[model samples]
Target chain A: MDSEYLGYAAGILTTVAFLPQAMQLIRTRQARDISLTWAATMTAGVFFWLCYGVAKQSVPMISANGITLLLLLVILFIKLRYQDSTDTGEK
Target chain B: MDSEYLGYAAGILTTVAFLPQAMQLIRTRQARDISLTWAATMTAGVFFWLCYGVAKQSVPMISANGITLLLLLVILFIKLRYQDSTDTGEK
Candidate 1:
């Protein structure tokens, strides 16, 4: 297989990995168990990957990280929102 | 900054992202909320990245993916173990 194809394959696999967790969290409205630190760190990491992708002009990295970053952001938002509710006993 | 440095930087950021979650899971023995699908998918994805790294002979990719794969495997193990105990009441 071509190197580019391999890169895309890897990207797709990793990028899609977040979907199940994100969907489950959205469906169940449960984010208290999810670590905010993990979400935040992963988001920052994905952002760096996006920057690296742009620097290298790599389509796979740019596209994959772009979508992954969005997903992580949503997760982060849910985590924070639910955490706040739990902490304040508002939920 | 050099492109190589950017790749390493990206790798480090993304790779280290898992540590917080892993440590939390280990310290708290809580894996009930972690999606098995996510763990499985990510493990597979990191494996592909490892393969891609080998094919491309990229040091950063190889090193980062290698370590990430191990961490994901541990996470998968914890998820499975806890999930089984929860299901069977063995824990």
Candidate 2:
């Protein structure tokens, strides 16, 4: 297969892979085993990746990381909400 | 900053990001809230990414994804081990 095809495949698969995680969190409504540090770290990492893509002018990286960033942010948001929901429930 | 630096930063940060996740799983000794599907999907995706790296002859991609694939495989192994541990505990 062409290298471009490989890049596309990698981009699509990796980008789509994050969906299961986000969906699982949403469906289960639990992230007890997931480290907040991991979520935050993944967000920061992917942000740089997106910026890297922009610098390289690679559409696949830019598009994939762009979507992945949004997904990670949603995951982060949910995690933050769930983490504090109990503490704030009484208020 | 150079695009090379951006690539390096993205590669380094993203590669290091998985360590916390693996550490979290090991420390907690629990995978209850983690999605088996996510673990599996991530492994497969990273495998393709590694292949993409090889095809492109990109040292950063190769090095980063290689480490990520190993980490993900470890995670998948643990998730598999945990998911069935109770059922198999009877033996």
Candidate 3:
């Protein structure tokens, strides 16, 4: 029961944490510091977490990972946009 | 069985994702794009995840969250150091 609370709390915290980062990218329009590798890996990772949640039938995980995956996709989209527009490299 | 593999893969990818960001920070020494809010929130979230892992007794969660926590702390520490030297403002 306690661990369930902890899981939910942890999931909520981690899930919401990306909001500011996504907002920051929008606000500053700076993706120079955000590595392409990082975004790609996180996207894959979060996607898998979502699958894990679905397989395990865990609501907190499903919701948390789902929301965060969406946020991460936004982040990746923004980062790539910036990359394509400004920076010139493999990225 | 399949989901277990997915879980580990997810954990590993997410855990290692921070590496590039950390390396970028180290290489560029640029904290301008790095947000204090992002760092702080992520740190708190990851710390909670670590607690959750301990509660759940999941090796993948524990190891992944633990290593990522250290990397995040490093990211936060470096960001703070840069903030102190170069920038002035709350957070």
| Best candidate (score: lDDT) | 3
Instruction: Score every model by TM-score.
Output: 0.85, 0.86, 0.87
Instruction: Provide the TM-score of chain B versus the true chain B for each model in turn.
Output: 0.83, 0.82, 0.84
Q: Pick the candidate with the highest DockQ.
A: 3
Report how far residue B45 has shifted in candidate 2, in Å: 1.4
Q: A37-77, model 2: which lDDT tens digit per residue?
A: 88898899899989998988988789999999998897888
Tell me each candidate's i-RMS in Å.
5.1, 6.3, 4.6
Ranking by lDDT: 3, 1, 2
Q: Which digits, one per residue and each the tens of the lDDT, describe model 3 over residues A16-74?
A: 88998888888867677678999899999999989998999988778889999998998
Which DockQ values do the candidates obtain, in the order shown? 0.46, 0.44, 0.51
Q: Candidate 1 or 3, higher lDDT?
A: 3
Candidate 1 structure quality by residue, lDDT tens digits, B35-62: 8998998898899889889999988889
Clashes of each: 0, 0, 0
User: Candidate 2 or 3, higher lDDT?
Assistant: 3
- What's the DockQ of model 1? 0.46
Which scores greater on DockQ, model 2 or model 3?
3
Local accuracy of candidate 1 as per-residue lDDT tens digits, A1-91? 6876766777888999888888877775656547788888788878888988899898877989999998889888888766644322111
Tens digit of per-residue lDDT, candidate 2, span B1-91: 6777877777787788888888877775666556787788778888888898888898877889999999888778778877554321121
